[model samples]
Target: MLSPSSDSPADDVIRALADVADLVVVPHTRLADLTTLRIGGRPRALVECRAAEAVTAAVGALDAAGVPVLVLGGGSNLVVAGGDLDLVVVAVRNREIDYRTVEAGGAEAGGAEAGDGDTGPGGIVVRAGAGLTWDELVADTVARGYGGLECLSGIPGSVGATPVQNVGAYGVEVAQVLHRVRWFDRATGTDEWVSPGALGLAYRTSVLKNADRAVVLEVEFRLDAAGRSEPIRYAELAGRLGVTPGERTDPAVVRRTVLELRRGKGMVLDDDDEDTWSAGSFFTNPVVREGDLPTVRSRVADRLGVEQAEQMPAFPAAAGGVKLSAGWLIERAGFSKGHPSSSSPARLSTKHTLALTNRGSATADDVIALAREVRDGVRQAFGVELHPEPVWVGCSI
Candidate 1:
């Protein structure tokens, strides 16, 4: 526990919260040390909550006192500004996992299920603390002969962030298997479980994103009982698995293949790989109105030859728009992999054009500068705007 010498309202709140069980306060901690981007300055204080109640209590106290609060988990999808920040960081560290068998008609078995038939005909529901690493939960289910999360393997972040960001990879979004979420409602001051419908899950975004409406305490995801993976929807993944699109495969194999693919693209974290030092896929695939697709394509055709323009990837978004590949637009706009130069502090990832990386010495300014250059270049070349996917704190591109 840390005690501040001053009598500031923020410091006083920290001192009072330190007395609460399962909560510890630290005087100094940097967002760079906590976030995947490894770029950001220090917050006024850091409150490490070891239990869900502590998270609610700490956040509630800070909120009531009119102090700014940042609910931090794995810090995988955040871009914090450099220099001393004015907010207090509530770090969620509680980790507990339970799996229950769902009886017919949506009934849950008494207590946590165990034994060979754990994955009954009605399927299994995994209840994981929000603080648990997202990949760890995926790995555990696969190890237990379960499925549904294999396509999402190799994604970095906490279980809580999955619903907040509606995290998806290889064509499987968290919305597909989400059972329910236990969240602490900031407005109501109540903790409750809500269905996926309440989340407003969309491509790489949710209502919980860019807002402090609620704090997720835990998450439950439904899994396949028969040990079969979700139908493969990503063309590259299905091709690698030697199966047609929408065909199912073994969960273990899916996990392995996804990991290999991610590593090759430098999406997986590795200390020695500077390419992995990125906030994974800096921009969301741009979604254009159905009526405007032709104009964008015409622009593409005019710049790059007609053959190359026709080869551009565009998927029909569920939300009534055509989702164009951000990476494709970036490359076609002339920002190649490792854009700018090898010596620049912030450059595009050598393996993937979508990821803007920090090469050991890049500041938030450097990363922001690169992002702006790429975004502006794409907009100028294709008449399409690329929006950043990560949540920005005290900064914007």
Candidate 2:
């Protein structure tokens, strides 16, 4: 409850959680060592659980005891603060899969969320444990000649965190294929599966993502057993696949193509590659009101040039809003790829302007400074506010 400012409190909290079965507890684990950005400080305690039940019990106990906690998966989408964070880290590590019942009938692919009905064979119902690596699952599904997750091929994180942020790539978002999510509700202290609708899943957000309200234990996804992909919705991917929008293709091909595209943009995780030392895109696409589009366009034309402004990317989004590319705005505002210099520990990714990377020795402050600069630059140039895509832990920009 006191947030473990001292070692005694950390030990006290760890001892309390350790009373539960099969929970491995460690003290003073550096947060940077656990995240993709590699830019956070140490936490008071860290508890890694091998089973879903253990995860649930550990989180529940910590919550009930009033101890602040962070439910960390692969730590891909997190941006934490510097110095010392004062919370417990509960690492979810349950990895199991049940791929029984491959049949020929009509069942939804990745379930109703994907917006496709049971078309060909009902498809295989593969439920993955929460802690399973998402890309690994995608690879397995593609290897088995199944189709569904190909569009999300190279996202780096745990499957459990997928639904949390409605993790999306190419043209596919997890909400489309997410059948259901099983989680341990810290409030009620009950572990159960709930429909996706209950999650309030929207673009890059869900009730559970940064809330720490629940810890996801497992996830169920419906895949095409006929070995075909879901309809291709992204223009780039569809073009590469030689198919029109809303067309289906071999799942393996889709995965390969998506991975290729992601690598080009530095969206895929590669340890040896400094370009991939990021938490993916740093900012969400700015959504503007339909009625204000003309004004926004005029502003862009005024700042840059009529031709350049006319060439800006704008797509129709939900609720009469138009989504504009954040990366374009950043580059146009004078922050090119690898901006600020080639020597800074924190800088724009050399491969993509949308990502802010930790060049092997950046701190949280360094990352935050770069983010603020980019966000402010975009706002000053275009009067559009860019929101960060990753969830912040113990830090704000």
lDDT top scorer: 1
Tens-place lDDT digits, model 2, residues 292-392: 87887888899988998899999999888999999999999889999999999999999999999999999888999999999999888888899999999
Question: What is the C-alpha local distance difference test score of each model?
Answer: 0.90, 0.85
Off by over 4 Å in 2: 1-10, 102-121
Scored by lDDT, model 1 comes in at 0.90
TM-score of each: 0.96, 0.93
Per-residue accuracy of model 1 over 193-216 as CA lDDT, tens digit each = 888888898888889999999999
For candidate 1, list the clashing residue pairs, or say none: none
